[model samples]
Target: MASNKPAPEAPSRFGSEYVDDFATRPATAFGTEYGADYATDYGTDRGSDFGNDFRADETGPERAWEEWNPTEESVRPVRGKHRVAKQRNGLARSSTVLGVGVIAAVGAGGMATAQSKPPVSISLPDSIADNLPDAKSLPGVGALFSGGSEAEAQEAVVASAPLTTAGITTAEAEQGSTDAGEALRARILQQAEQQQDAADAEVKAAAETAAAEKAAAEAKKQQDAAEAKIAAEKKKAAEEAAKKAEALRLAKLAASYAIPTSSYTITSTFGEAGSMWSSGYHTGLDFAAPTGTPIKAIHSGTVKSAGYSGSYGYRTVLELEDGTELWFCHQSSMDVSIGQRVTTGDTIGRVGATGNVTGPHLHLEVHTADGTGIDPMAWLRARGLTV
Candidate 1:
């Protein structure tokens, strides 16, 4: 069937198989189709032109070889860059080390500064500096900062000054301690001496008081003994004076009385025994004398009788004031009359032997008022007259 579309062309080895009657063809197509030498000519011509262009655009091989050889100027930039990079790395390392060292130094310096400046100020003597170690010889202080700035040098100088000054202060403190010890010992010695003195004074005072008391007691005892001696002497003298006064009173009474008769010899006592009398014993004392001797009155008395009685011739009786009778018996004569008064030493009668007499004597008798006879010798002696 004939359709109104164009017919499909066959696949050719050169290109699209469709051909136009008016289309232009390439020159290489003619040579390819005819298998001619035109391809060789064209290749040879282009090759020649390429050779000519290469000759015109580039230098010779000798010149290129010469350009490729390295020179000092050519290597300078690379080495410079490498050297700069190495220097940068070195600077970085140095900076890092410096930073760490600065931090450590600051920490240590802060502690040192704090210790050096105390709360209180202490000034030390200059002589201590002579004995100190030199700051330049110290390890991390002076030598480490020798090439550093002026501020670092000043810091080292400041750090070394204190150690020398502290040595002088220690010597002064030792001297002060020695002086204080001596003063304390002296004060203790003074107090002990004062206490000892006070004790000695107290002992002395007590001894004095005891001695005074002993002296007073001795004096009192001696005074009492003397007073007792005086009282005994006075009593003895008073007793001797009383005995002398009694003896003088008896002497006066004897002088007032008298004896009845004198110059007569006693022949018989009142109590004598005889057979010559009318009674059993002798009743009267006998005074033997010559006849007519005077008889005296013994004391002042009145005559009661003067007459001859039996056996008593010419008798006389005298009565005294106390009622005692004195009888002159056997008298030769009566001198005193009846009712007559006679005194002591007066004549009352004469001695006789007329009353149955043995011899010429007076027979005197003492009787009471009732006519009873008593001893005549005892009656006379009582009046202080010795008979």
Candidate 2:
């Protein structure tokens, strides 16, 4: 008879404590895209189940196997999505590897070109061309994606031969002794220096202008002062010339005239108020002297008369060309007759007590053409003769 009881599960070949494939293991595709580092982490997948899809490393020594329960995770089929056993997956992995290799090759070439290295061109033998027929026609992997100069980059696509994908940039390289940034910096410094030079020139021009203005101002001041001094000297010279001319005129007039009597005293003047004269005023200039004092012609004139009257004893009359008359009365004796032309300083008579007078004197009278009497002393003084 069999007992209706459950049988005990057999122990695993490795151990009893087992690891959950999905719980404890790091997730990894059997074939990852980077095929090179794929196996590097596989051995250390943190308690991975060897019985699962991961292939054990054949080159290293065998590692101890861990226990694995026959649960759904372990007994289920391993994910064959990226397995090399699957033809489609295998093709995809191969294509991915080729693309990564191409990208790496292009990156290395780009770095070398950036370092100013010479580009490397490729040559494929005819036998290798048939093996990689799609290499020249594929979109990203085609020769059009490869890099070179402008002419060469364009030519590479049309070229039947394959070329290396040396990563030259599409934009043209700048040609100069220095890069753009350094050149721009140099230009900025040059502009700054030019501005500084212009500023200096402006300052210099301003200084020169100021100096010129100052010099011009100084010259104007000097010129003004010189003009003033010259004007003052001219005025002084004119005044001095006028004074000299006046003195010469007076001297000439004095040379042409004479006094009426010499060594005589001026006892009476014209317009004197006295009781002795019948007209109540002295009408002539009186020159009192000794009885023998000689009387001279007052100026160059013709004597109109020389006579002895009742009160004016031995009187003489001198007439000028301009009708001015000089009467010499109270003369002791008359030397010139009427109409006698006489010169200045010629003796005409002598002093005497005449004209109902009290003493010896020569009485002289001056009258204009209308018989209007004037002061004899004033008339004589006007001709530069002092009596």
Candidate 3:
């Protein structure tokens, strides 16, 4: 926005700083107060009128020209100001550039075109064209001349004639520049809409692809969790079924076994420390009972031996099918003979106080096929029998 302030007067061609400056100074300074100084400088006498001195000396005005000579500092403007124009717009006035161009063209070329003639375009470099003055912004210029460049002014150069109207429709041609401008604007807007739609479609496709990948990842995570849970459940079920089958097998084995003695109480267990026997530790289980109490066979086995042993008094040995041996010691009598086959609960001996026995009691021992004695109680419990 240019300021609406008043412009200072421009320096004139005839050594005038302002057009009204002469009226502000003294009416006659040269012939009166400074007359002696000027006369001495020019070697002439001062007079009210310069008509005699001007004819006599050809150097009258030339001698006085030194006082009015403008220097760079004296003529420098305080601000941009002009009388005819409130603001500076270009290199020069619009009419001045146009008139100069036309005069130069006429002098160089003899040809001239009428209103019916096609337009003639003059091309200039960008440096020159950008600096051309605007005519529409001038003081008194009418709408006849546009403020645009020469290219824009081509159609208006001769409005009565048609120039470059090849692509225009009949309605736009008759209607004026307004309708032609609207048609060009419509095409530009349509192209912009198509570009916008293409960008929106690309964004939508990217969003859908990302959504599908997220959904697939979530589903895979759930499936893996479900498969792991099913595997854990199957492992637990198999372990429980194995436990149930083992219990059933042990129940059937318990039905085939029985305790060796009746009306007896446990008086000594295996692995007991005592000095009474020769081995220092008791190697057999003892059942305390009244004399003549019957001792039965624990399991189905053959009689390995039946005799009166030295410290054991009368004794009996039974051998099971799996090469395990059962010995009955401290017995008062033996009933099973050698080579006799007996089932569980068959009488094999009688409890007594013979053979270094404490009171009346039956001593029992169990061994593997190698004759190594083990705890009778534990061995009998393994076969599912109490006592």
What TM-score would each prediction reach against the true structure?
Answer: 0.37, 0.41, 0.47
Candidate 3 yields a Cα-based lDDT of 0.68
Q: How does residue 10 of candidate 2 score in lDDT?
A: 36
Candidate 3, 61-175: lDDT as tens digits:
1222112458997898656533242222454433443343333333332223222223346689999888887766443342345455554455455453333554566676666
Cα lDDT tens digits, model 2, 131-173, are 8757646533455455545666566545533233223222312
- After superposition, which runs of candidate 1 have C-alpha atoms over 4 Å from their true positions? 1-250
Deviation in angstroms for 137 in model 1? Answer: 76
Which pairs of residues have clashing backbones in candidate 3? none
Whole-model lDDT values for every prediction: 0.63, 0.68, 0.68
Residue 131 lDDT, candidate 2, scale 0-100: 87
- List model 1 lDDT by residue over 7-43, tens digit each: 2322332222222210224546635642234333332
Decide which is better by lDDT, 1 or 2. Answer: 2
Worst 10 residues of 3 by lDDT: 56-65
Clashing pairs in 1: none
Question: What's the true lDDT of residue 297 in model 3?
Answer: 88
- Number of the candidate with higher TM-score, 1 or 3: 3
